[model samples]
Target: MSNSKLYKGSLTTIILKLLNEHDKMYGYEITQKVKELTKGELKITEGALYPALHKLEAEGLLDVEVAKVDNRLRKYYKLTETGTKETVNKLEELAEYIKTMQALVNPKLA
Candidate 1:
């Protein structure tokens, strides 16, 4: 699948889960973390990532903190209380989705 297609439905959950694990993260950090976690199977681009981050912040699921890091202002994202709860639900949902897809793709083996 195209990287965009691969991440299509799961980007938000990935972001939320990463933030939940790390407590806080910046854009590049998020991108790199996904790459590391997926062993480069998934790549999050700045184009896809910034818009989603902005939307999540607008939706109140994330809180942004600005700090000067290495002489540049970086925006860090952390889960709000609502985001934490939402992450749990999203993870459960994603787990079910993976199971369903696996069954479809490998029913005989399963």
Candidate 2:
């Protein structure tokens, strides 16, 4: 599958799940983690990633902290209590989506 298409639907869940796993992470760290975990199958673009992060923050699904790291200020994101609940919902929804797709693609086996 094309990189864009593969990552299109899963970006938010990936981000949420990563935060769930790590407690907090910055933008670059999130991107790098996704790349490493996926073995380069996914490449997140700044244009796509930052906007989503901002949106989630606005929606109160994320809490952001700005701190000085070395020579620059970095923003780290963590799931709020609401965000943790939402992450569970999102993951369940994603799991259902995958199962549905699998059933469609392999009806006989299913």
Candidate 3:
């Protein structure tokens, strides 16, 4: 969902999952990639994105690399060893959560 509140809890998991798939990415790139994948249905705003990145970095699940691109510094993030492990755990948790939601949302099929 593009609505930030709806996806707030899972932002870290989404970020980690993306990093797991793509090696490394900067903030804007992550937002763009998410939007592209979701076909513009989901947009990660600056206000929501930076704090989450900082939090993940604080948690030791992410590593940051800064590079000078043109005249600006672009910071890229990748999963740490624990982060890689965490990606698998978080993904499993997310999958289970989605399954539960699906079942709840469609009890007849469940």
Candidate 4:
């Protein structure tokens, strides 16, 4: 998320997709999950993550549920009705983007 443009625009889509698969997720959990999935190649920094989450929440694409867990209130996020549909659209768009990049980078592979 630092300087790679590919990872920049896809942060929200990634969050949405993860929420689409899971019931809900807290901030650190999301970051750790991304790291585990990517095998440490990609990292979601706090500086980038919170603002994006706030933006999505502001946009009505996400719902928050706060609960006390082990003496700490964890704010979990999940997709809204609109976010569910938006996740599908964003996934399709990302898939198309990957396809296009493949075609451009390696004509034979695409």
> Using lDDT as the measure, which candidate wins?
4
Which of the numbered candidates is closest to the native, going by highest TM-score? 4
Candidate 2 runs further than 4 Å off? 1-3
State each model's CA lDDT, in order: 0.91, 0.91, 0.92, 0.94
Least well predicted 10-residue stretch by lDDT in candidate 1: 1-10
Which portions of model 4 miss their true places by more than 4 Å? 1-3
- TM-score preference between candidates 1 and 4, better one: 4
CA lDDT, candidate 1, residue 6: 59
Query: What is candidate 1's lDDT per residue for 19-109, written digit by digit as tens?
Result: 9999999999999998888788788878989999999999999999999989789989999999999999999999999898889999985
For model 2, state the Cα shift of residue 94 in Å. Answer: 0.4
lDDT of 4 at 65: 99
Task: Please give each candidate's TM-score.
Answer: 0.92, 0.94, 0.93, 0.95
The digit string of per-residue lDDT tens for model 4 on 48-69 reads: 9999999999999999999999
**Rank ordering of all candidates by TM-score, starting from the highest:** 4, 2, 3, 1
Weakest 10 consecutive residues of candidate 4 by summed lDDT: 1-10
